[model samples]
Target: MKTLLKNGLMLDEQSKKLVKRDILIDGEIIAKIASEIEDEEAMQIEVAEKLITPGFIDLHVHLREPGFEQKETIETGTYAAARGGFTTVACMPNTRPPIDSVPIVEEILEKAEEAGYARVLPIGAITVRQLGQELTDMEALKKAGVVAVSDDGVGVQSSKMMKEAMRKAYALGLPVVAHCEDNSLAKGGCVHDGEFAKRYGLQGIPSEAESIHVARDILLAEDIGVHYHVCHISSEQSVRLVREAKARGQKVTAEVTPHHLLLCDEDIPEPNPMFKMNPPLRSKKDREALIQGLKDGTIDVIATDHAPHTLLEKQQGMERAPFGIVGLETAFPLLYTNLVRTGELTLAELIEKMTRKPAELFGLPYGVLAEGKVADMTVIDLESERPIDPSAFKSKGRNTPFAGTYVYGWPVMTFYKGVKTWDQADIFVTFEE
Candidate 1:
């Protein structure tokens, strides 16, 4: 069966305008997009006044399968992603056994296929077991079907080892997605080393911890000419370095999370773990710099480092609890409300960060609603306002600080490969494949 979406305004990224268009999806491919696409056999659905864009892609996400099922599973995580309007997510390799070997990577792909929602591209570990002492076989990992190589939870500590890994990754034509951190400088600090930390008498994690590694990795990438990507950039200096590297025409890219752009160290009301994350939220100045970075093209993508920790793990207080918070369910609405609605970023700019930029950076065949492209799309309700309720989240990790915040631009329907994967307003008309 064919599906025809009518009366939807499609975003024109180049002109920064929304043009009214109709889409006709045939099987798994988008067959046509024009002012009025008529197909007698198509099941037509009127998406009047709604915005239709390419489905979102989150480059950094944690599904927590094969090891930490209690925290999150691939099925639940992807469900949360689809609810957030994402049709593709690149899951981080920090599972129980970690996605280091071919078997583990294969397992993730198989499970995601069985789950049947968003496409899950497994990120293979840069080092075996993510120990960082010895490098994993990049060739084998790439052949096993990995989007990239990363040791995301922690940085590759040994400079020599990292250089070798980058060399190997370059040879395999894979990007090295780094979690930039110098543990020696970080010194076990939980929150940002700024006024908030000093006022609360909490140990601070200095900005250099992240930047030092960022600088080091950038140099390594420049020397090796590999596609080096910085993960969840939070520091001002890190942004500056990436900007300078890009200015020099080096192969480097960086991503910023919605939480870091919207919240700062001062926003932490109390000593709560929800506000705690690795490369902890910095001062207002840092947040401003991150926004500016996004505006000026220093930040190439917006990835929700959607790390999900169990409630018990998060309830251990700011200092004792593990670092991380859920983001898949709240990222778009939070950014759309706070950033786009406030005039900090245009809807096209924000959508580009979440869509085309990630796809272009990773060389994935997504993030476009053109003819002959995969029919991965989402219809958004840009008019309705709704409060975020964590209890309503499909993810097991109900750990977020955005609860009770009213926001607009809710995703009402999501289609992945022409299949209705998620529908909130009963608008999805199923078409036989």
Candidate 2:
């Protein structure tokens, strides 16, 4: 099957102007990109006014399959990803039966393949069962196609254990994605340790709890010569540490979530569990620092950290509920509307972070639109304005705090490997061989 996207504003980093061109997708590859193509035999898609860019790739997401199915499964989570214009997502291993071993990793890959939605890359747990006590079989897991390793829900408490894991990861040429948090310091805390927590009389998690581990991990990475990536950074001090580490020429990269970029402690009206997340929302100063870091290239990517939870769980008080909010469905729209549209970032820069940066960091083959490149792409309606409706989400979880917020720039069509996976108007379209 051949599909021609005609007369669209292509957002290619190499292109000077938002070129008014056509893209011909053949089978699972972009067959041609040119100023004009007269393909009367192919199915024509008129996207003259829309923006066509490489499919988005998220480095961090929680598809609660093989464990917490009630919250989300591989099929539903990836479907949500498709609706949000992401073509690939790397899922964390903090599941019911954590993806720690080769068999578990294989199981996730098999299930994702069967689902046939967005491509799902399973991240193996750095430690057995993510207990942070013993390292998993890095060689076996890598052989089974695990893209990376991480103890995502919590930080590896023992520096000795972390060093061992880093050594194994380095030997295998795999990056260890770190969720930096000091458990001892974060104990019994539900929100940021600042004025909000004091006013609400709630236990707080201090910034040092996250930055301390970040500092330690950077030192370890420097010593072992391993690639280390930080997940969902939320503190000003942590940003400073990462900046210094980069200046010192350490193999370190970090991602900041949209929540951290758009929201702060002051934005939370009350102890809403929807706002409760790990490395909880920080101060205005911290938020500003995160934005600056992103602008200056100190922060490498903007991942969703798309954690999902049940309504019953989120209905509990902030201190009692679980940490996370649905992000795969809101990330692009929020970033497009809040950052790019507001001039905080250029469209080219935003696309670079969402596509090329992550693909280059992880050594993935997708995230670009060119001849011989995989046909994973997104067609966005830059002028569309819609309120965030959790009911419209494909994921089972609906714990987002941005429920009724209206935002511009929504994804209208998403394609994975030349197959249309989602269309807001026509959800039943199928790709034929």
The residue pairs that clash in candidate 2, if any, are: none
Q: lDDT tens string, model 1, 1-433? A: 7999999999875787999999999999999999988899999989999999999999999999989999999999999999899999999999989999999999999999998889999999999889988889889989999989999998999999999999999988999999999988886799999988898888999999999999999998899999999999999999999999999999899999999999999999989898999879998999999999999999999999998889999998888999888998788889999999999999999999999999999999999889999999999989888888877788899888888889999898899999988887432221111
Error of 1 at 231 (Å): 0.4
TM-score (all chains, Cα) for each model? 0.97, 0.97
Candidate 2 error regions (>4 Å): 12-16, 426-433
Residue 77's lDDT in candidate 2: 95
Best by lDDT: 1
Q: What is the C-alpha lDDT of each candidate?
A: 0.92, 0.91
Reference-based lDDT, residue 303, model 1: 93
